[model samples]
Target chain A: MSVTAAKGFTAAGIAAGIKENGNPDLALVVNNGPRRAAAGVFTSNRVKAAPVLWSEQVLASGQVSAVVLNSGGANACTGPKGFQDTHATAEKAAEVLGRGAIEVAVCSTGLIGVLLPMDKLLPGVETAAAQLSEHGGEKAAIAIKTTDTVHKTAVAEGDGWTVGGMAKGAGMLAPGLATMLVVITTDADVDSAVLDEALRAATRVTFDRVDSDGCMSTNDTVLLLASGASGVTPEYGEFADAVKTVCADLARQLIGDAEGASKDIRIEVVGAATEDDAVEVGRSIARNNLLKCALHGEDPNWGRVLSAIGTTSAAFEPDQLNVAINGVWVCKNGGVGEDRDKVDMRYREVHIVADLAAGEATATIWTNDLTADYVHENSAYSS
Target chain B: MSVTAAKGFTAAGIAAGIKENGNPDLALVVNNGPRRAAAGVFTSNRVKAAPVLWSEQVLASGQVSAVVLNSGGANACTGPKGFQDTHATAEKAAEVLGRGAIEVAVCSTGLIGVLLPMDKLLPGVETAAAQLSEHGGEKAAIAIKTTDTVHKTAVAEGDGWTVGGMAKGAGMLAPGLATMLVVITTDADVDSAVLDEALRAATRVTFDRVDSDGCMSTNDTVLLLASGASGVTPEYGEFADAVKTVCADLARQLIGDAEGASKDIRIEVVGAATEDDAVEVGRSIARNNLLKCALHGEDPNWGRVLSAIGTTSAAFEPDQLNVAINGVWVCKNGGVGEDRDKVDMRYREVHIVADLAAGEATATIWTNDLTADYVHENSAYSS
Candidate 1:
């Protein structure tokens, strides 16, 4: 179950003839609820797609009756025409769902700088709306995939309420809202302000910490909708925790399905002077191509880890740093410690711990190893 | 004509058994002159190699009678022992050349965290010193190769004085003193301060702007030695220009021979509010993995370029940005412009011009496209 796992939500996925390959390319999710509260987080990139620009305005009303997403063309860099297409899409969704146009949020993915086939997409929206069902969450999840090999969805259950989310991203997966589209729906009694607070707090530690390729996308967006169909309002902290749990699960799935990755690496920075320091150090290691390649090759090259840390301005002395990879303390006091050959690398998951020895603050960032397949896949992605 | 193209300098290269492959791994360059003036630049990496730490101290004296460098093991992260090994290497070089230990600068490259075999290295210093000759410049350049496919050398001749240099690096190339070991010799009648100013100025635009793979090494070193043997003091501007020309030539060579690179990408950022803004934008593009991979596939994916520019803090309106690849303006006014199909990408050199439309400042950064070969080379390098 994805968004439809929650109460009073109907979802549908359909082929819109927009993808030349004849794949499912259109998805529609409508919140038929007693309460229509919504919040959204979009890509931090300044060059946003047309859908993001339109959805940003829609979210300001603190109400969303429906969300419509497409996977054949990202309405980005199409100038004024692209924005018009996105506006028209929202209008069509609003008309079909019998709601205000300003209450519809739009999301689009696939090739950048390409305009949507409005003739196919607009018709597909009506078809998707007609076929919408409470059990159509999986179909909606699958329809948003670009290069992803599998669909991703997560659910967190609370007292008489549930939160469900679906995400799609396979590349350009850096932080700052990540390069993905996500939709989370909850059947809980909440206002727009509470939904907004919970969504931001959940995404801050989950989606914002997953940096698979260090390339941010221009069309990333995450939306949360509350229907209040369950009528049971949980504690604010408990509700926020449930939302975070679903987001974290989805974020983990995103990293696991990152394009052409051979290993999923989790970098944990401990003893940082502050949480920001930990994040900065973690991102530095996550983005170091040399270290990523070494991780791919299963070589416990702690020197590269040190080199990456050295590039950061975090508070740490060279001799005070320590690194442990795969439970092996390969480097200690900024020098070789254990025999690197003793480190095991047969597993697909690698854990690296970098101790800054500066303070007690810590943070963890998830990323994937650099591989020839990653290079090959991205080299030919847009072709 | 490498370092020996200038007067009063002799060089030699020899196999020291440091590399298991039996490649030449030792080089020595001596300056027999009426003036011993030297200037040096090293990697900004905080975890510097032993040689960089040692050489940094040596250059502080503004005199260097001899220089020694070796490949096969970067004497970094060996703690006090690594520093001791570098000190011993310099002392051995000084003993062989009959100069003070403080007058000997050292450099080392290859895998980090490994201590050099001092027994073999010290003996090799004597062998290299005995074989030092004016004609050995090319041999010395050859000995410094690590992952480099070929040795690189550049020479610029003035009215009477000349500047010649050698560089070796095939990976881990980035800014803040690129990941390479370079040695330049000049016969101009200039003081250490003048040489320092000229070297820094030359490197700021040349070596410091070449960002191949964006992985800075801990052992980068560029040393300039002036013997004043020509007895001709060229104008400061003329001398600085000559130094910059040679450095630029070497930087281009490094990019051309970058490990597994199928394309050399030159990212020129113009219409910036300041030079810093231009450089920042240029570097952001150069370090973008998705754009590099797209370039490797010869795909004119200007959307990736716009996304990269959007990540920078440089002054620019998203709608005012423009990008041209190879001569075709694929993106203009932050939207699709000329037909991307009209862009040609059959050449190894790809030129990308990003017009920020913010101001008049401009900067260019050279980088290599990401490819499968690069992944393969770096993945198994340390193993």
Candidate 2:
């Protein structure tokens, strides 16, 4: 179950001819309920896509009826015309759903600096609106894929309430929001302020920590919509936890299916002075290209890890650092400790723990190994 | 002519067996002069190599007699034992050169977290000292090679003084000094204070601006030695310009010979509000992996350039950014401008010009294109 797994939600996926290969390229998700409450988070990148700009304004009103997303074009850096196309898309979606244009949110992903096919996209909006159903969540999840090898969806159940989400992203995934497009739905009695607080808190520790390649995208977005059809108010704490669970699950899926990645490396930074310090150290290690390549080669090279940490401003003396790969403490007190040969890395999943020996806080980041396939895929991506 | 192009310097390179493959791995350079003024710059990385720690102390007195460098191992993160080895190497050089240990400098490059073979290293220093010659600069340059395909050397001659230098680096090249080991010598009549001022000013614009792969090395070092053998007290401005020219030439060579790189990309950021902003923008573009890969594939993907800029805090509106790839204005006003098909990227050197349209300041950063061979070379480097 995806977005439609929650009560009072309808979704549809259809081929819009936007993708020249004839794949399903349009997805529509709607919340039909007693309450129309919504919250959204967008890419922090200064050069945002046209849809992201439009949707940010829509979320300002704290309510949304439907979300329309496409996979064939990003509609970014397309000049003023790009913003116009996004406005037209929301108008068309609102007209078909019998809602106001301001209530429709739009998202687009694919190559940047390209204009969407308006003729096909506008007509496909009507087709998707007519086919909307409660069981169309899986198809909707599949329709918003670019380089993704698999669809990502998650569901978290609570007392008399449920939260469901679908995500689409592969490459250009990095912090400040991974290059993703996600839509989440909930059937709980809640206001927009509560939804906003829950969504931000959940995403801050989940999707915000997944950095696949250290390349941020201009089209990243995450939206949460509440229908309030269950007629049962959930404890705010419990609702937020459920949202975090689903978001965390989707973040893991994004890392596992990262383009051209052969190994998914999890880096945990412990003993930091603060959570921010832990995150800073974790991100430094996650973005080190040399370390990622060594992970792909299955070589337990801990020196690169220390070098990467050295570049950061976190509070730690060089001699007070310790690192463990898999289960072996290969480096202790910043020197060689255990035999590197004993650190097995034959599995697809690799775990690394870095102890700063400075404090008690900790953080974890998920990333992928850099392989020849990664270079090949990205080198030929736009060509 | 390399370092020995200066009248008062003698150099030697030898196969000391520090490397298992039996390549030349040790080099010694001596300033036998009326003046022993020196200045040095080291890696800004917090986890410095033992040699960097040792040499920083030696240069504190602004006087040096000899420098001993090894290419087989970088004595970093080896704890007290690594620092002890660096001290012992300096003592050996001082003993052979009839100078104090406090006047001897040391440098090392290659794998980190490994101890040097003091057994072969100390004895090799004596042999190198005995074999030192005024014409051994070429051999000294060749001895410092780790993954470099060719030895890099440059010389600048004034009316009665001359400056010459040699550098060795391939990968793990980034700013905070470009992850390279360099030794420069001058026979001009200049004091240690003057040499320090000139060295820092020249490198701030040259070596520190070349970011090949965005990986900072723990063993980066650059030294400038002055011996008043020429007896020519030239103007300081003329002398500084000569030093900058030679450094710029060497920096270009390092980018051209970067490990596994197919293209040398020069990113020049113009129309910035400040010099620092220009440098920051240029460095950001230089370190962008997606942009580097696109250049390797000979594709003019300007959107990647904008995305990289978006991540920085540089001053510029989104719609005011313009990018030119190889003389083709593919992106203007943050949108598609000239036809991308008109661009031709057939040469080994790729030029990218980004105009922020904010002010007049500009800075250029040189980097290498990302390729599969870079991943392959680094993956098997430690193994």
Candidate 3:
């Protein structure tokens, strides 16, 4: 259960007094590898958290040995104190792990504009380091979460290497990206340059395609670390595919845990003139609340589905497109085809397929259905 | 209260069996004009409704005399039959009005995909025409609604002319547009070409900037008709302002009626390098479900506010962006500002201002807070 399965990393999570529930809030992951090579992606938001600022600079070196994250207190808008907390966490990780703080990453989520309790956090880090184990992956994943109800992790065993990772998010998931905190580890032998390239390419189509609530996160971070411990040096193409699979799986789980979500819906847009067009159309429908609500009700409301797709500029004639719900051909050439009741949305998982009638291109976006519980959960969440 | 207050026009609404509610589902608005000029804007949804197809073509001529609209069944995705229904409605309106069907406009809303009750509709037009009156504006507006909780109308008087409009929409509102149906009329003597130019320019900024539930409608239509009865055409500049005011007012009212909505929220993005940037930033925040939910609870969650703004591409230093909740500056230059307690969100309206700190451009978007009722309403809607 260790990230070492993905590449080169040791992970740990401990109580840091960031949450009133006393849930583990501090997590540390180190890339104990052949190279301090890493790639990081931050939130697209203009109002980033303090940790995002520090890590954006740290990742600039493409050399990251460790990532320290905390939940329950976002350490954003806390001014100079927020920046200091990020630096302090990194410095503590560097000191204990025997590495330069410049090689460390920092991430924070939960209530923003709150100062971290350095006394509790520093001691907690020491405990996490002491308790770090090869099987601490699940605990570490749990520590990075906020409103997420369940821990999300995926592992893929390849020819000689493996990819395993964890993510935390719900509600603030959208097409551009989800309000996600992701950490990927691979034991495959890969270069720093290749890691950066592979990580971005995988994410562009994986995590970037999930649109749950249409809101982005300030502390969204996706880190890929290669430990090169497997002695398995696969081609870049093979490694990229494995990474994509892990991401796709974890993203699926994230959507499954989305706030008040009853269905983990997959929107597959195919036959578009271009990949970009397919993705655009898919994402547009993926984030539509009306369509999402229809899915939650098990109504198989194909009309709402069609209207959602019509919102994009994918250059497909409405009459030329075809749609299938849960394997039922509900529409063809823009008209009703099969009985919508033939498809059942009662399960936790639902599938929607759209044929753009343009060219050969496709994209699948993971999403969640809108539910009353979702509204209740979100509305009742106090600041 | 009639559309013909602008002069040279007649209007009517009659039972057409388009609505299961059995209300008057048919409406007609004719323009008796000094100039046969017209302008229209339809939904950006790629999968348009049947009526939208007909109107899109008719609008290309820029000369329209009548608009035939039906409520109850949206004639969307009924395939060829839906298109034919729109054509039939227009032809009937034109034949009775003694003009080519091409000179007639068509609009429809309600359940999508169901066939129109043409058996009763063909003759329904004659009844509607006979009932056309100067005070039928309210009826025409009510005849086009599906889920609207209340009908909305606005009137702005000029020195020599008047602008009156009616709109109906509840949820599915966003910055790109709302799931809206708007009809505007004025007696200002303006040319068709000028009307077209002014209409596009005004709508792109006003009606197109509200994101209610982030769902684009397949039946959104906004038509502006002008009659020269006033014999006083103000400058195009003034006319544009008047039109914008009417639209802005209606947009606000639409927000007020947002499904399960308890508060109307206005998001203002200012100090951007371009108006487009302002809208991009504003719409991003307005579409954030978390922030909207927090606002709903009367909790000034400024943290969610800043993080939402962080998700945009507008040029601005994260530390230089300022956010205010309910007119109280909560985040200063991307961090916490004054006391958030001063911000009151208990009223039926809320204002969130984001200062991009890039340029002078500004944009405003209207939305509704997320509520439990909204969830309850939507979850069981299709069922």
Give the DockQ of candidate 3.
Answer: 0.63
**Candidate 1 interface CA RMSD, Å:** 1.2
Instruction: Provide DockQ values for all models, in the order shown.
Output: 0.78, 0.74, 0.63
**For model 3 chain A, the run of ten residues with the poorest summed lDDT:** A1-10
Query: Model 2: per-residue lDDT, tens digit, B102-125?
Result: 999999998887889999999999
**Mind giving the per-residue lDDT tens digits that candidate 3 earns over A1-383?**
63545655778888878788999898888777876677888777766778988999998988888888888877877887789888999999889989999998998888877778888888888888887767778789989888888888888888988989989888788655578888888888777788888888888888899888777777788888777788888888888999888888888888888998889888899999999999888878777777777777777777877887787778798888788989998888888788877887778889999999999999988888877777777777766
Candidate 3 ranges beyond 4 A from true positions: A4-10, A31-37, A158-162, A175-177, A230-238, B2-4, B32-37, B60-62, B175-177, B231-240
Query: What is the CA-based DockQ of model 2?
Result: 0.74
Residue lDDT tens for model 1, B61-134 = 89999999999999988888999999999999988789999999999998888888888999999999999999
* Candidate 3 per-residue lDDT over residues B112-212, each given as its tens digit: 66778887777888788888887788788878776787778888778889888888888877645578888888889887788788878878877898788
Model 1 CAPRI rating:
medium
Error of 1 at A382 (Å): 1.5
Root-mean-square deviation (CA) per prediction: 0.8, 0.9, 2.6
Query: Which candidate model has the greater DockQ, 1 or 2?
Result: 1
Tens-place lDDT digits, model 1, residues A227-274? 999998999999999999999999999999998999999999999999
What lDDT score goes with residue A360 in model 1?
98
Give the alpha-carbon lDDT of every model: 0.93, 0.93, 0.81
Model 3 quality (TM-score): 0.94
Task: For residues A299-322, write the lDDT of model 2, one tens digit per residue.
Answer: 889999999999999999999999
